[model samples]
Target: MSIKVENLKHIYAPNTPFETIALDDINIEIKTGEFIGLIGHTGSGKSTFIQHLNGLLKSNYGKIFINDLDITDEKISLTDVRKKVGLVFQYPEYQLFEETIEKDIAFGPRNLGLVEDEITQRVKDAMQLVGLEYERSKDKSPFDISGGQKRRVAIAGVIAMKPEILILDEPTAGLDPKGRDDILRNIKEIHEKEKNTIILVSHSMEDVAKLADRLLVMNRGKVEFFDTPKEVFKHEERLKQIGLDVPKVLDLAKKLREQGFDISDDILTIDDIKLEILKNLKEK
Candidate 1:
């Protein structure tokens, strides 16, 4: 029901010109049903870290425990691990190969040897979760959909597996503003309805700021902080050093604070800040 990583380290092409530390002595714990926003600049090891959660990248250098099962142990079932921790990588839609959207979404569940009826239900339910109309899109080729809808199909494929831990790396990458907003809302629905341990990786502080209950900031393969968004944004200089700024909402809050606004806490979301501003105006 949780993921625990200790001293995780990964080196790429060691002893060669491409040698680099991809993950450096990382340690963190993720509890069940927690919505975590994983934020870091490009090459900050965010992808590398999430890959290890599902056994996609084995770590001989560190130990990872998922749901209290040692992932590295010989007795562990990697297949089960993957079934429990579903990962949706950037451009996941590109991996879609089935002739029809229904088949593509059903692939994972089918592989689990689910009954035909169960697989069908899973496909229907997953598509519904992603806002895809099962009756309309089922027979259509995945390539025939809009880019955002294609992405939804890919994500539905993973959700069909009913993974306990869902890791989404830049789920909104390359999306337009409205596409990004739609995807973020879909993810929130998934978290709320499924109650999975969700880890959303993105560089956009604003996107994560609105959805994440907790933020995990990374820099140079190291964890900077793992705390509630309000608490984490309080370290403005530390975030700046990592080439990240606090969410603009919080930045505005800070500026208003200096100008004699009596706002007492960091405002991490657009909605919350708007409410506060309106309340203050009404009071005045």
Candidate 2:
């Protein structure tokens, strides 16, 4: 589904002593089947922005449109908005509370008043989508699963709702390297197979560079840059000024270029760097 935010502004604790503007005239447009990455340091309004997409947090000013429907309208149901846009918050595993894995993953559809058979079918489908064996683990307690499994269960809960757009906030946070990679791969697979729009909120430049077709950089409640990863990462100095860094490989490529090497400064991945170096050596 397409998402559009126009002149959005959000303020925390309005009319209070600690009033802080979290979003400042933020405007963004995301197309269907696109993977967009949002990057910023802490307190950059990334979290607050994603909350607005799913109607979790209402905008104080401005409007959000999902597939041409104005979500900010009072007549619109927040539940309907959420059904179309699923949000998996940071550390989602902490939110798993059901006794069994199947029950936990089925909660969303069940709450929507789906029939028991349909909910069961959705639970099985979600588990399979996340690479879990439903029959083997359906009866087990979610608490008894490993950290990665628990994370998958939490994601399955959202997937069971069959959202057209999936918004993940720091999906790799607080996981071992293997666990992080596993989750990232699963998410990528789902995006590829389902052709769903994805918005990834993360602090890791490398992760964004590798996954996102476009990047949005936020600073102090404002969007500083919105463009392709190559365009956004070109402003290394500006990003650093805002307490962000480019991908490590891109930084290294920049240094190599400074040293007069025949390499592209836009090399954002290890494979790209290796191929570039090999091609240059062959030409020499």
Candidate 3:
């Protein structure tokens, strides 16, 4: 599904001493099937902006359109909107409460009033999408699994809802390197197979650089930039001014360039750097 935001503005504790603007005059569009990375320092309105996408938070002044339907309309049903926009929050594993993994993953489908057969199928598909074996893990207690497995189960719960637009906030937070890699791989596979629009809110520049088709940078209640990762990272000084850093691989590429390695400015990943270095060596 496509998304368009126009003149969006939101404030906290409005008309009070503690009042603060959380989102200010924000506007952007996300095309269908695009993988967008949402990045910003803490308290930069990233969270606030995403909440508006799913109607969790209402803007004081602005309009939000999902596929040409103005969701900001007062008469619109947020419940229906939520069905199309699934949000997987940070530390979602902590919210797991079902006795078994299958039940937890099936919860959303069941809530949608789907029949037993469809619910069963959705649960199975969701589990499989996240790399969980349906026959092996379905009956196990969610709490009994590893942390990374639990996270997958949590994500599976949202996936079972079959949302066209998926928003994941810090999905890989607090994981070991291996666990992080596993979760990221699952996300990539989901996007590739499902062809759904994905908004990944992450603090790791490397993660976004590897996966996102475009990066949406947020600042203090405003948009800083929206462009491809390679293009956005070009403004290293501007990013630094906002307390953000380019991926470390870019730093390595910069150092290689300093040493007359002729590395291209478009290199964004470790694999890209590796291939470039090998090619340069071969030329020498």
The candidate that wins on lDDT is: 3
lDDT of each: 0.90, 0.92, 0.96
Q: Model 1, range 120-179, lDDT digits (tens) per residue? A: 999999999998889998999999888899899999999999999999999999988888
Model 3 segments more than 4 A misplaced: none
What is the lDDT, from 0 to 100, of the residue 31 in candidate 3?
99
CA lDDT, candidate 2, residue 187: 88
Clashes of 2: 0
Error of 3 at 22 (Å): 0.5
Regions of model 1 farther than 4 Å from truth:
none
For 122-200, candidate 2 gives per-residue lDDT tens digits of 9988888888998899999999988988989999999999999999999889989999889888888889977899999
Top TM-score prediction, candidate number: 3
Q: Write the per-residue lDDT of candidate 3 for residues 132-164, one digit (tens) a residue.
A: 999999999999989999999999999999999
Question: Ranking by lDDT, best first?
Answer: 3, 2, 1
Q: Is candidate 2 or candidate 3 better by TM-score?
A: 3
Residue 246 lDDT, candidate 1, scale 0-100: 79
List the candidate numbers ranked by TM-score, top first: 3, 1, 2
